[model samples]
Target: MDRHAPSTRCAVITPQLSKRAARAGSDRRSPEARLEEAVGLAAAIDLDVVFKGLVLLSEVKPATYLGSGKVEEIAGIVQAEEVGLVFVDAALSPVQQRNLEKAWSAKVVDRTALILEIFGSRARTKEGTLQVELAHLNYQRSRLVRSWTHLERQRGGFGFLGGPGETQIEADRRQIGERILRIERDLEQVKRTRALHRTSRKRVPYPVAALVGYTNAGKSTLFNRLTRAEVMAQDLLFATLDPTLRAVDLPHGTRVILSDTVGFISELPTQLVAAFRATLEEVIEADVILHVRDISHPDTEAQAADVRDVLTELGVDPEAGGRVVEVWNKIDLLPEDERDRMVNTAARADATDRPTLVSALTGEGADGLLDRIESLITAGRVMLTVTLPAEDGEGLGWLYRIGEVMEREIGEDGLMRASLRILPERVDLVKRRFGAAQVRTEV
Candidate 1:
């Protein structure tokens, strides 16, 4: 479904080095894949890519980023195609963006701007809107450099030289500054509210499992499958922007809060990340994190690394024991042999929390995933057997709300024997509420 109302005809330009420096790891993706990904990013914002090309650069020009001849060549294509926008699939300085726009006679947006535009459009909630606006303003602040000589002119100067754009620029800067301050204040309140919500959850605490992955890696799809809640699971990039929390039941009857967060991407702008820190706090507070991966993609490993980098920035350790479980998803699209290999690979791992192979589309191998999640969420939990009078409905209700009731039986003596799985932090409280003599705890 198209969420954006306006669509602009644009040209995509991906500039790469003719001879690139060797880098470590498994990120040796072809330029064609990179170009395709850039095109997808453009399409994410409803931009019609009329002309696209990969330009090889021996060296980057400071003023225009691309060579003079290459700039002229692209200019010719932009005019011929009547493109209203040019998307450079690389970082561009303010000067380069301005110069390129002047040469092409069209608006120039870099990869960061394209992603920000998608976020600006997809943000639904008040907090999401504030975060996007804060990031947008921060990004625009850097673009306020004096490009035109007229814009550098001062009012009431010695030489009586002042440009109208300069005054407008100053006014815009003031307005943006005020807006940023207001957003910062609003975000502070949002952060505190989230913290309060977390505190409240602790009272009846259900473990939280957060879903994180690369853009279009089926995170939303897996979230929908597990929670059975429709949350805009689509093939499009950034389909899920606002964070959603739903209570899901595990195989063993334990309930957990499943959080579906916005997808991460390669080279995510630091400004955006900083602005969304409040939203990402959910991941930090999660008891278990499900790192969903599109194993069918050719660049899956690289995408995993990008996701890990973002998680690291958010203070979630992916490699630490019981911190994050890797979910190898989208196996339905893989060939039979590949799927078998993936299953065998998962089975071979000896780690406590090994990767799980599942197809969220067809509900394949989902039970195993749920079992693993249950184990992870209750890793340090204590199992208790409490004996209380069968007539004590209040005590039984409290136990059911705070902990998972594994089993319950009523004895002939009119006493209830209930088994429970509870967090260690609440063990003392549970014992205090119901006499310690009535509870037996096991690790």
Candidate 2:
């Protein structure tokens, strides 16, 4: 075995800062829970956490992120404990990262860098890799000061310009800029391909339902349950980084395309949102949306709000004006009494449009969710009855293709009569094909 296998051991430190009472209240989640989530996320990407701590940065001296005394204390702990990496769960300026690494003699990363690393490691598809690379370059462009010592100067002809000792930061930035342009060109191609695919789906007139929720809120779990595909559903932040689409057959034999999208979260870095715009466009184009929630969590309500905030930023109306459904997922984790109380409350109140509660892990109430989706899709269908000549099978075939055939009968005049619920556009098509005399009932 290689002696230099990837080091898994790491430590986390969250610096304390004071804010207004309302701001603190809004972030009432315990630091322990946040640390646990961070650790869980690291483990999912194969990191072995050895230590975790919290420091108060408000009183720190010299450095804005880490005080000199606190830095010395952490350095001693890392040296004694043999920790390979230290993760600070807050944003740190490039200068702060360099200073902290120099003091601790270990790799130091902040929240943004850690997230970029995770995205780098998890990106699987070509477009995903390109997006990650672009984001990484954009982030690195700001932190070029971290790697200034590695640059070299050209020999002979151009050596006099910089005395043969140019900083590597300039070269790195140039290379990164070139790579970003290449990635942008490649992504443009991907965008065109995706647009073409969307056009094809639209021609079929299939309504789209997109899944959006907080990370690890069982959005992927519910998607897997409904679509029957393994989509890397794990209890980690940003587990599913790419958008996936599948054809889902409703209870009424109607087929619609369902899209599973990247999960949302609080303070999702603006850079990331801009980077993943291509992937998030799936949510924007969806006909209906499912806001999945982990109802069993103590911060369930807050989580819901966080998701809504992200959607609104993306221009999705939560009220959906009747186009969105709130899916309260993970009911299996709730106690029997709590579940009963919630179900009763949903029945009595029209608030939240009476969210549908289901255990995506156990397949509980899945049928009810399917029914709700079908109702939403078919709500605008109009009932119609029409008669066609026996030889004109095209009209009947079109009905079966575009509408749900509710009933059919043989008329005394050897004509085929049928009652159907069809989309308004398809109803017009039917009238154009069979004339007004063939139409008998319209509701």
Candidate 3:
């Protein structure tokens, strides 16, 4: 979690495992691709590689997570290579991790632990940090068998040591549980505050557009293109951890709040999802959703399903259905013929109005994307006219905040004449504030 500290060298275990099973029947990713993803994730954290090995476990040896022979071989390699750490690409039981670490005289980390460490390191905001810490504590709760001797104990507690301290593991779990409860309470307060803010935004009635996609699928890139603000968009898992909102104008000058949300991933840890529910409220409350897909990835289809699965789990009503715009991003990475074929197929899909192909990095097809967004949010059209006094600058500002002003002119009487295309809700606000006498036209 220390960004400034020197990078640690460790050997990757999953990189060495190869699946002999053909890819004809399984529902999982190919072994090679999964290993590549794990390694790429590890490299992002700046972990140096000393060695990589793969171990296969027999059904009977599942408790150890590796066969005895493989374990002995790993132990030999650790000693011979002077490895400082060993990273397993799969989840391991607490007993297994402890035994492996003791046998090799090196630190041992499983896939879940590695991911938690990454989340802990990447979290920036207070809420984000608290959520990550809560998830980490929940994960560590079940792995409390391993203990450290040096920890201060509570007064009057019974213990064999008879001194003033207890085992570090027990003290750590107790502290973690208390901290987790406090974080939950704080997050509940944050959620309530966010709900109030959402309600205030609703009064203006600007449509909300939420970005949902698999990790590293360029959702952030497209979000920046639409909102014209710089947000972190990197080719790494969960690069954009916090949800960001910005006002964006479509081609017709209609304004809507665009939200860039946390990217989804296959098999996302349950603890993480529960902890970050407050962050994902953007998706649930959105008037329109943009399901961005990386058409260039080999696992694109599965990735799309994964995003939808998470959305469903978040109670976004996959069947009740709000407007969904499919944005196929990273088209520039595909060959021209393949891209054309995808575009044609997308045009024909009955699930959506039409798919928009875009390269978020190079700004290709961004205008078309904006047009589609406008169509989805506006349901084709809106027209309105209102009158505001010259002194009503606050009302004029609200007009600009809500939608595009098509025309503005000062009358001889010193009143401002304004025509705008706004969402229906905004038009209602204008009518209520200025009175029916100010109305000119509505469509």
List model 3 lDDT by residue over 69-112, tens digit each.
77778888888877787888876777778778877788989877
Ranking by TM-score: 1, 2, 3
lDDT of every predicted structure (CA atoms)? 0.87, 0.78, 0.77
lDDT score of residue 162 within candidate 1: 53
Look at candidate 3 and tell me the lDDT of residue 8.
76
Off by over 4 Å in 1: 1-6, 18-28, 148-167
Comparing 1 with 2 on lDDT, the higher-scoring candidate is: 1
Off by over 4 Å in 2: 1-7, 20-28, 59-64, 146-167, 389-420, 440-442
The per-residue C-alpha lDDT of model 1 at residue 350 equals 75
Supply candidate 3's per-residue lDDT for 348.
85
What TM-score would each prediction reach against the true structure?
0.93, 0.87, 0.84
Candidate 3 lDDT for residue 327: 83
Error of 1 at 125 (Å): 0.5
The weakest ten consecutive residues by lDDT in model 3 span: 146-155
